[model samples]
Target: MSHEARQARLRPTLISFDVFGTLISVRDSSYGAFERILAETGAHRVDVEAFWEHWEHRNIVHYCKPYRTYREICELSLEETFVHFGLTGDGRLINHYFDAFPRFFLYDDVVRTLDRLSRRYRLAVVSNIDDDLLALTPLQREFDLVCTAQRAKGYKPDGALFRYLIEHAGCAKEEILHVGQSQFTDLVGGKPLGLTIAWINRRQLALDDSVPRPDFIFADIQSLNDLVEL
Candidate 1:
């Protein structure tokens, strides 16, 4: 069948969201915390760009390994970045990121859009975060199903977390529409399972050539209204 024909036939009963970049506004608070951590640790000479590249890359690497608490993974990734950059920073500096979580807010469009989407579909959040950290954000009250890496004992792009969501949701893969910002995690992990995928390209990033194209692409959560009528 043609791609448009295939999508036209998908009647999603569950709308699953990836938190962080998708629902909550965290980039500023997260990076601000990281910068504060660097200053506090006296890592003044560290290359900011290179440090994030190494740290985030290490996060993906750690996610693929045996499950660890998200905080542990963050600390490990940051500590490794320190070593990779010849710095003496403490892994515990990741606490700054955690401390900033309470300050993170939902995007202006999120609650109104979700409220509308919920009228027609069950809503859920599948995130790569510890449950407590997720609880700190406004999103805690918003989802019907909450699947976190801590509960799954694994992370995304590996499929364990997505599978956990599928099992707990008790629905056929075709009934679920998984929305996320990361091509590597959401598209790479959810597509192979037969779940319909939507790429919320909040950053306006180019779709990576390595992953399969998503069933739909949108600039924000509000675009979900295009998929389902309220």
Candidate 2:
């Protein structure tokens, strides 16, 4: 807590962010797409659990086995949900889900805050999405660097992606800060990679003392901008 130490973290040369829950809100866009999908396929009344919990669990398990795009995951999820609820997994419904899936509204403070911080730290996005959409689709303005599973050839919660980034970005382990919402992806995976990670605990999930801890934690992004000065 000395002025001298605070000065050191003032400007990191590089900061990487997780795309989905951290920088963009995919809930409305993704679920809305699924709503249309389920309706067209004559699916049973939408079970919220299918969309949020089961699909997420399924996707992570699927992605780790072999490479897949975020779009592909969405497609498979539609099939899985339909099968679980005993509905027809029609091709038309799957296509509808894919078409609407890419639309995501940015978080409230994303643009201004990123612009403000971009002045000081080189900003990049590291995500498990397909190389193109995951890194590029959501934003019109360019990021300094963007890394994806297609490029990294692997998924997060695996340290390889983060390690490749640090090597490619040409930054030291301690200087780079990673911000993400998933404790599994951002904290546990990023720990061995050696970056100082800030867990964006958006849902206010209780901390598990058992897991590897984050160097910094914020329940919401409101406090994110202040991190450059921490």
Candidate 3:
């Protein structure tokens, strides 16, 4: 279907969001954390970009296992990345990364976009994060409901978290729109479950045709206002 047709069909009562890369800016924060740790260990020459990609892949892999605290998952993933590069994984460095969550800012458009959308649609967050870690972010109070992997005991690409949102929202799957930046988790996970998926391609990345396509695509949260009229 074309974007206009999808837009016409979308009359969501609840807008579910993936917090990390959607509302909050994870890329910069992750890079900063990795850079600091690398400098501390005299591994500054290592490719931080590649390190982040590996760490993220490992984190997603860990999410598939029995649920662990997001902190534990982060520590484990960081350790895996360190071992991959033959660097000693320092406990303090792991703690630094864990503590850095509160410092990560939202994208400039997030608050305004959310505020506007909230006037029309109830907002909820479904994240592959622990409750405590999610509480540290500025987005903790922005949603009508917040579901985490820690609470669901499962992560995205599994549909457990999205199911939780559906149940809690007291709405049909068609009445909710799940929006996020991760194609593998959010799009692939939510689309199969009959929820309308919105790919928030903030970075303008090309869509991977192998995965399920989102019903709607927006460059950022702000673009949502154009598709969803109050």
Report lDDT per candidate. Answer: 0.85, 0.72, 0.83
Of 2 and 3, the candidate ahead on lDDT is: 3
Error of 3 at 19 (Å): 0.6
The lDDT of model 1 is 0.85
Root-mean-square deviation (CA) per prediction = 3.2, 2.7, 2.8
Which is the winner by lDDT between candidate 1 and candidate 3?
Answer: 1
Model 3 residue 221 lDDT? 86
Model 3 scores worst on lDDT over the 10 consecutive residues at 89-98
Task: Kindly report which residue stretches of model 1 are placed more than 4 angstroms away from their true locations once superposed.
Answer: 1-10, 45-50
lDDT: which is higher, 1 or 2? 1
| Cand. 2 Cα-lDDT | 0.72
Best candidate, lDDT = 1
Question: 45-102, model 1: which lDDT tens digit per residue?
Answer: 6766567768888988888898999999999999998888788888998898899888
Q: Please write out the lDDT profile of model 2 over residues 1-230, one tens digit for every residue.
A: 68876675546778888878887776655777667766676664766546546667667766656766667775687577667677776634656544653567787778887887877778888887776565344666678888887788777876767877787787787778788888877776788777888898877899778668898888766576666663
lDDT of model 3 at position 207 = 95
lDDT of 3 by residue, 11-114 (tens): 68888899999999987876888888888888978998898888899888887778777788888888888989998867357676667888898999988888
Model 3 global lDDT (CA atoms, 0 to 1): 0.83
